[model samples]
Target: MSNEEKQAPQDQVEDVIESEVAQEDAALVDELTQANFRIEELEQALAEAEAKAAEEKDAALRAVAEMENIRRRAAIDVEKSRKFALEKFANELLPVIDNMERALLGTVEDEAAKAVIEGVELTLKTLMTAVAKFGITPVDPMGEAFNPEHHQAIGMQPSTEYPANTVMLVMQKGYLLNDRLLRPAMVMVSQG
Candidate 1:
């Protein structure tokens, strides 16, 4: 009931209020710290996701480039196949052409035989034209420099008109299918 007694009780109440406020401030600081840590963790996870996405993008681009290269190569292969489709057939017909050439080289003095020869000559010309249309070309090395790639020398002989190592006579004409040699020309070379 006195003044001192009243003052003591009021001080005790103030101290209790200060203690509660301090406890609340400490809890708020702890919550803020936890939130900040969670934000940092989220940022790290986002960075990792971005890196993975970049790697996947690079891999996809590389795969697309590889596919394009394969497509280009396949297109080239198909074009080559289209150009050389009749290679085997042309190669098989070479022996028939050689025999026809040999038959044409023989002379016929009789009138009836001359007509037959003319017919055979015309047939050979027609066959040659057909083969040429399919990119089959003749390799006639007669009177030119002999090359091992296109010409096969059966024998060498001394020649007066040609230089040494030159093709003197073509024994059997070879054929080429589009720049590639189907058969080598059999030839006689001039001796060095």
Candidate 2:
């Protein structure tokens, strides 16, 4: 109950309170460090996600561009097909034109035959004009140099009127449709 006894009790109480406050400060520091580490981890994860999203977006754009190019190429091919669609029909009609020409070249001894020949001549000319307008052109190789691409040599004959390897006679005329060979001219070439 003296001064020293009273001072001892007061000092004990202050030391207990200081220890508790120090423990609380240590716990708060630990929590703050943990929070900072978590923030860094979240920042790294966000950066990775953003980079992945950018890569996916770029891939999608490239795919769209490639598809557009393919569509454009397909449209061009379709247009070219449409332009050449009449090639087969024109080729089939070439024989009919040849027959008409042969009929017109026949001798007309009687007046009735002459009139019929004249009518055939007119028809052949009209058909030729019609075919020409549709990009159909005749390949008459007679007296021209033989070309393997445009002329098919059926026979070889000795000829003094023209040079060797020249087209002496075109057995059947060929045809072209829009600069493309529909058929090669069947011809007899002069032997070298």
Best candidate (score: lDDT): 1
Every model's TM-score: 0.78, 0.70
For this target, which candidate reaches the highest TM-score against the unseen true structure?
1
For all candidates in order, the CA lDDT equals 0.93, 0.92
Clashes of each: 0, 0
- Model 1, 1-192: lDDT tens digits are 999899898988988888899999999999999999999999999999999999999999999999999999999999999988888898789999999899999888999999999999999999999999888999998889989999999999997888999999988998999988999999999987
> Judged by lDDT against the true structure, how good is candidate 1?
0.93
Alpha-carbon RMSD, each predicted model: 3.5, 4.7
Give the clashing residue pairs of candidate 1, or none.
Answer: none
Off-target runs (Cα >4 Å) in candidate 1 are 1-36
lDDT for each residue of candidate 2 in 1-192, tens digit (9 for 90 to 100): 999999898988988888899999999999999999999999999999999999999999999999999999999989879879998899789889989978876686999888889899899999999999989999998999999999999999998888999999988899888888999999999987
